[model samples]
Target: MSIEEPMRKTEQEIMPARASQITKPLGYDIYPYYSLGDNKIFNGYSSLCDFIIEQKTVVIDGYVGVYWNKLITALKEDLIDRGYALNLIESKNYLKSQAQLNEMIAPFLGTEGSVWGTKTTLTLADYFNMPALTEIEKSTSADINIITGCGASLSDWKAALIYVDLPKNEIQHRMSAGSICNLGLDLQKEQTEMYKCFYFVDWVVLNNHKKALINDIDIFVDAQWEDSINWAYGKDIRKGLEKMSSSVFRARPWFAPGAWGGQWMKEHMPQLDRNEVNYAWSFELIAPENGIVFESSSFLLEVSFDALMFAQNKNVLGVHAAKFGDEFPIRFDFLDTFDGGNLSIQCHPSLKYIQREFGENITQDETYYILDCKDDAKVYLGFQDNINPTEFRDTLEKSNLYNEEIDIEKYVQVHQAKKHDLFLIPNGTVHSAGAENLVLEISATPYIFTFKMYDWVRLDLNGKPRPINIDHAFKNLDFNRKGATVKQELIIKPSILFEDNDFICYHLPTHKEHFYDVHRLEFEAEVEVETNNVCHVLMLVEGAAITVESADGAIMTFPFAETFVIPAAAGSYKMINKGSERAKVIKAFLK
Candidate 1:
């Protein structure tokens, strides 16, 4: 009789050190093997796919290895009997370190991306409003501080990094293999007058204000292929940014003619008036046919953030592009709208909700930063102070939220936004910049794959039904928060402000993998900082700052303070604001 005793469930055990999973590439002579039950061995064949198939059922517990030899031998014997001589193949030690596993897989991320530009001089205090950035150490929802590559310039680089299959680009592959592969970069070295000799990379990394310089094509900036690859790695992505200083660079407002407004916004959101907009610019390396756009419940405005739309391509992930950590592509915009479309609202789905419904393909989380605003520029941030989902939905369907009479801020928290105002909105947090307003939105990579919940009785110009995923909305809406603060409100201390300027250094407050938790250094003063990790980004907001050297011959300066990055290997650097106004900068570091 079967045992009638209580069930005995066992947990998996930890593994002891092993020689497998070494630098040896797939199909290498040194194959992986596992021991199973007696006479039930299996083979970890050379081919990665083959090894996976052969070891499919093998238990990998260090204490309970599944035999792999016998199984492979049996399969081989059968193949031989059938007159087939198996061929053995293996890859070289192409992998430099365990970190390469992620690098080898970057081709799986997407090609298109979106990001915002500066109005005047963006300050460190304003970065909190930036869209989300992916962090391998921690998600935006999670308390982590690490960041990877920013998408503000992702469009400018993605086409070269993705879509075109390199192997098929026979000539390009040869050039890359000879010129890029095996060709290591000397971080301490210099090449041409304007370029670094070995730093062949993909993107010219920068912060919001510095990147805005791209709007003026007349400026001749040094770029190379190695830096393009630099942009591919999380740690190295910040390499070239060390020299940026925001103090003296002239920042053209987004509203300036030829800055990508007027004719642009006129066609998309006819309601948008050129005068109301403070500034606009295209940060995309190359513009897409449709330009950058974002959606809300009732309002669908051609967003201010720039995006380089990729032609249809394969799935690629930049999980390891940032060698130091993983970061998400987030964008932002200061909407200077004249009317509050009764339907425009802020809402997002949760990770759990997206996974359960749309799987991994749909990832989203967003936040907003209120910039300059008029007294009447109210917004709908989060749900009503006290809300009953059922009751709210019942009224929402009736368009009560859409009635122009409904002052959205009264339902949530209404606050006027002056320069340097900051707000943090996590995913599932129901918030919106409401009608008749201007606000800076900082958020995670803008992937509209989320399941929408509500669209305030709004329609496209064609007057057709706009899609809504209410069930998904309810799944992620964060009902606990309202207004400017995130989940647990952080008390603001004036000490957080940079001296003599509105530059703010509110802690990003992240806790996860050790790489992204290092606190941020926000400032515009003549300050010096030592590097601890391999990467860091110093996004410049306002003014010009130069990196200068000390009498000890150990100083480095970023004279022009636009958004810039400093690599860990850069040693020590100092910043000096050349502008009459205070400089704004963020010192993001790896923990």
Candidate 2:
């Protein structure tokens, strides 16, 4: 059944030198950045109170899982000190019944893995009843009328808007800490609601200026960065905020635990709360849930990653802004299964299937770049040459019905994994990384359209069986990706592109269906690269460190396995190898 049992015929000759041979540079933990505290914020709550009290009707909207009571308390305390009569209206009480909320989310809920699918397919505004706005208005008739909720709006009257925003991770943390409570809301559903809220907020800030203008708004309170909240006001505040994020930006990473999670992150990411069972996913650059951290001298301010894109999409994304508008089209994440089990055997939906069924614009075309792996590590990909469509479907169905383990070796081809091996996973290709591997997943923006055919016969962390998607997976699975064809196409053999004393660039070929390409630069001293109207995402895959110096003289140092982006406007930048030994950097950009 296996065309090439070892996958690579001459693997021993092509394997890179052991990564342990490389020496890590001193003080290379990505610049040793510090967390900025409360005093660094430009404007405080008092300033927001002063600015908002000057207006008539104010609408304070926020993310779904925000602590509205705490925010209202802060605002009320500030306004009370100034001798102002304020009537605060809460939005949760205006929400429809639990039955209505359940009905609205039913379309997005189904069994996928051990966890249930909890994405909110509809808009946030659709979750509210029109009559609730009347109730909110009826209760607000004091010296200052302020309405607050996730669904708060300025549609009724010409009111000053105040958006109370929080980072996605912070909200997730609060949910985990039981500070923000929704009875039946799981983490997946909570995240989906917040992401949809982000879409709504981004659209409003970018397109509907007169209705809920960002610049004309009374205030914007961001509580994601520091222990204390940040408030920015004034007519030119948008310009100032844009300037704050104009130079360098990094999104706050969010981590989650899963059944097949590993111990690598729990051991390395000391900043994370290590008490969790195991850390599975580190959402580094998924902008909807990610937040941008702005570091100042005394303090650091943070806001949702989309906020900057909403305000300065043209400046941040450069040329691609016109094509994608508010959408950021690249994603980088970690899939660490070191000392753990294999991932579920899965295939992503095709472009037509994803758009028609899931309402996504792009398919999940992915690649796995092995950052680190053990000697026995392997990856399951493609299919056996002897696979039969009818038998495969019948076996999968019988396994689901009888709760039996799958004979994976007979159905899927396995490949030996090594450090820096690039595996192309186009849509409809069956793939999964085996145990003892630290995989850096660089792929298209879409992340959640995976149709898993089989999971090992083990219950989820919750002691429930994972759902098998045989029918849906069969519809999108490419049966032609088997035997020798898979070896020739799915696996990449890097070809020498450019070589010199300073650097040697190798082209990691991607599938023809992939719009992006990857290149690895092995350098001794330094090298300069240009961005020809497309953004480049950089990752320090090997060695200790590398420093990327922009044309404007901004130097950003990256440690091992750190990811960063260079905008198209960056023009030309020099990457200096900071380690004593040779360094390897992977560059992914549009073709």
Candidate 3:
């Protein structure tokens, strides 16, 4: 369903009012990096070219959206200027043609109107011409032979392997700018289509390839910036990752604006750009889209989150590693609707449905921990006691087709939201975060399986109608969760699990469908926490700042609204309050 563009004022004209009192200055470090040893990371094209020239044959493989043309051009000029003959083999030439790739991936792309796609079973080698790659791998007749592209490693060449990585957020930015294409494709598609291809196909194949070559990679490069490059030895990166897996760390969080954007993040996070429409999402620890940054002597390098998983999945996930393998099972993010519109009424796929349809191992079982909310804030969840499935579907479809507004509360139950309220949203439970609240969405790692039933009859940021998925929602909705059942099953009642004079822990239990549980530690001074062989995903919910000190005495300070992780291998850690008031931290771990 679609609608005509609605006339609306610019974001600047509709800015929300500022807070009356001054809050703590934003302490979120956008470029949080783990420290690599000095001299481990090298910068500049000159140094990179110098290192490549010394090797007889070098293959430079990287993620999609990396600027291979510029990288190769710079290396070619520098090597030729240094009086070395170069045999530059472009890896794209050996890949499958555009028409062939499109035909191969069509089954997974689904319909044009659909946002969901089946995870691809194809590998990087499936997109390549093996004969051509073998021929190139056999011939090395120049002073320095450089093979570079997305699947350069598939050549099976016995040479120095360098992997260039681009962050997921940067790849989206480049997609929006029309500067990059999907794997094995020559032409750029529209942003949404390109993102769909990237998510369902390109990323899946590339991540598999990268994991296979993680240990064999001799060097790793961060190609996020245009003018400069950051490179480091692969061994050093592995060492840093190993150290981090046994300690506490934070992924570099990224922010974005959306149709239902809010002013809460803009007002509290001073580092964010106030000129934007509004900040609606802060990707705190969504592992698939997040990157771990490593710093060395003032230089910074970022490798995708998968690198950490591939290198040390056992240490990071502990006993759960056996089941999840390289996948991180938990996610924490901020859904800001403060002084903004309500979120689209949506529900996620059930576990069996997600597995059969999307090939995902987990469903998006989520919980909204209300970190802050205005007095009138509310959360739409479940259905009324007298809800009719057919009638609800008819009303939603009519709303979508005719651009009419439906009385949502007539069907769905709306509960008042307050600070520290935890609402459990298992798969198939219809829910939406109402306006004037900051929701810390802690959930399973499958983040993109939402099926929106209604969108409040509003135009998106691009002035286009947002996708409505009534059919998909109906297929997965749990009508049993209605009225009294909703309150008994979804609304979390906090109970004191542990206590003392100065410290206490409150257990906010999740639903039966959820594999994880939640605990809020409120401490006036400090509290010692044991991991118990399960990784802990935590956020500083109610304190200005707190210091997380590992057993080995490595300390990292996280401020309010910051999401950090304590690996299962960490064993024990201490959270020392650095603020004037009691520190409250939300902790999520395996059940």
Candidate 4:
């Protein structure tokens, strides 16, 4: 496929250089990776050279590959490359091994283990001392400098710096290592080893820094501003680059969740400070160095993710992208069957269907993390003791167990789900987490691609029967495996606990592919906050927090806590306790 045209910010909106300022250019690099057949291909241009020639005014039009090189060459020969200079980047021979390929490419990436700030430098430091020499930048006063393209998914794209773009009426998701698509994502997930950039944590994003720093855009970035609820006093705050933020305040406090938004604000509100207008964003938290703050009692800084996204972007950018997140989100999903969705009768389609049509891959694996239930949640997993795919389909069709127009019983055996249970359901498994209970769903795509067997004839949210993909699913459902799930328990250390007046927290990395570190916290403050990750999403089952911060340091504290969210690029910030007792919260890394 041709490179998607680069989305460009209007030039007229860009700040003009001072008449007396030097017009020199700077340079950097951007690498693009694609695959051909089972083989992998790598290419990039003199990112440094291009930056120099593009000078101060440039559009990140497209990637420079074999074809792009020709365009650059033509531009250079035509003399239109005047302001935009580009040096060619050499290509290395393609290696035969995947491990070796990663090795060769790793060096060009952001420093590994570098502590990319996930919150306002000022605030994060106040609560947790530098775990390592960390990088913090102020969203306001910090000079803009670099720009580069970051690979989607994995880790870097999540916690550190994620790009924000509105969703089009249609989206073309890359599939099978950029090799093929149309294989409906449900089936393709197995063929492609797609992984998501863990969404809840800040570390993954920090590791995936690939873009150049830009100074022209003065928008403040902070994790705390995602909600109107405040953070604990001195919650993790961030500053840009090296400068300590001189101001802290909320950019958007009116965007908290709960239906009582207006009534809540009317009671615990403070007059808006015009001096902080230019420096405020709905989500960027700012609190001045002197300690003065601005906020409200009804903000929802920490609430359901979709609620926060709608509130923040709509108020600030005046645009609405779904709950997909500020820029990109690690949308891993999981499917479990039992009585919840008809299980025994349904199945998934095979690899061929996924690759040719569904456009799905790696991120689709289903894992079950059970919370509670009756004698544990009984699930329909795998094929019944001895049934093969052929027999299973026959039983389903014969028993009238497979019908979209009428309810049918999926005769697959049901298993139990205890706390912390782990069930890896591969495709073709007519299994589902069938018990009614609280369970954490994990996977790559946020979709329900089930070939339902029976739903007890339950109507969908729209009061319509949910259609079943019998033909496609039966082909993919795995018949080789069956029975109950397994669990691997780890000890919870005392060190992971964090409790205070504003919140509680716990973290553990270095456990698995650095996939994630669990975090749990609670808060009730009107503090400004910022981070370097896709930001944090706090599920508020209990208390609340109001976030308050500004690019120039205006503290925008909400009176109450609702679920809240944080973005990766957020700069300086803080969270102030506004209620009685400590509010509880949990933070998960989306690495």
How many angstroms is residue 402 displaced in model 3 relative to the true structure, after the best TM-score fit? 0.4
Question: Listing every candidate in turn, what is its Cα RMSD in Å to the true structure after a full C-alpha superposition?
Answer: 23.7, 9.7, 5.5, 19.1
lDDT of 4 at 260: 9
| Residue 6 accuracy (lDDT) in model 2 | 25
lDDT of candidate 2 over 1-591, digit per residue (tens): 111122111101111112222233443221122233233445466767776778856888765445565667778988888787877776656666778866665555443222223334455455566665554453344778788766576335458877776665665555443455342232233433433423333223323332244455556566642224666543334654455333333455667777788978667654455667776777867766776554433333455667656676676667677877766777888888987889999888888987776555677899999988999999999999998988988888887788788788788899999999999999999899899988889888888667777888777766766556777789988989999998899889999998987689999999987878999999999998877656777888887888888775677777777777777766778888888889999988866
- The whole-model lDDT of each prediction reads 0.31, 0.67, 0.87, 0.30
Q: What global local distance difference test value does model 2 have? A: 0.67
Tens digits of per-residue lDDT, candidate 4, 1-591, equal 333433221111111111112232221000001111121111122332333243432222111111232333443443334442333221111112445433432332223432111111111112111222122221232222122211211111112221221111001122312322211111222211221111111112221121222222121111111111122111111111111112221122221111101121112222222222121011111100001121113111121122122224322212112333332233321122222332334544444554334333322334344433446456555544555666655644543443333322234665566644444444455655553433344323313345665444455433544444455566666554553322111222224464555444554321231233445444555433344433443333233344445454444333332223344334434665544665434333455
Per-residue CA lDDT of model 3 for 456-534, tens digit only, reads: 9999888999888888889999999998999987999999998988898999999989999999999999999988889
> Clashing residue pairs, candidate 2?
36-300
TM-score-based ranking: 3, 2, 1, 4
Q: Comparing candidate 1 with candidate 2, which one achieves the higher TM-score?
A: 2
446, model 3: CA deviation in Å? 0.8
Better of 3 and 4 by TM-score: 3
Residue runs of model 2 more than 4 Å from their true location after superposition: 1-47, 53-57, 91-143, 155-159, 175-218, 224-228, 234-248
Best by lDDT: 3
Least well predicted 10-residue stretch by lDDT in candidate 4: 27-36
For residue 349, model 2's alpha carbon misses the true position, in angstroms, by 0.6
Order the numbered candidates by lDDT, best leading.
Answer: 3, 2, 1, 4
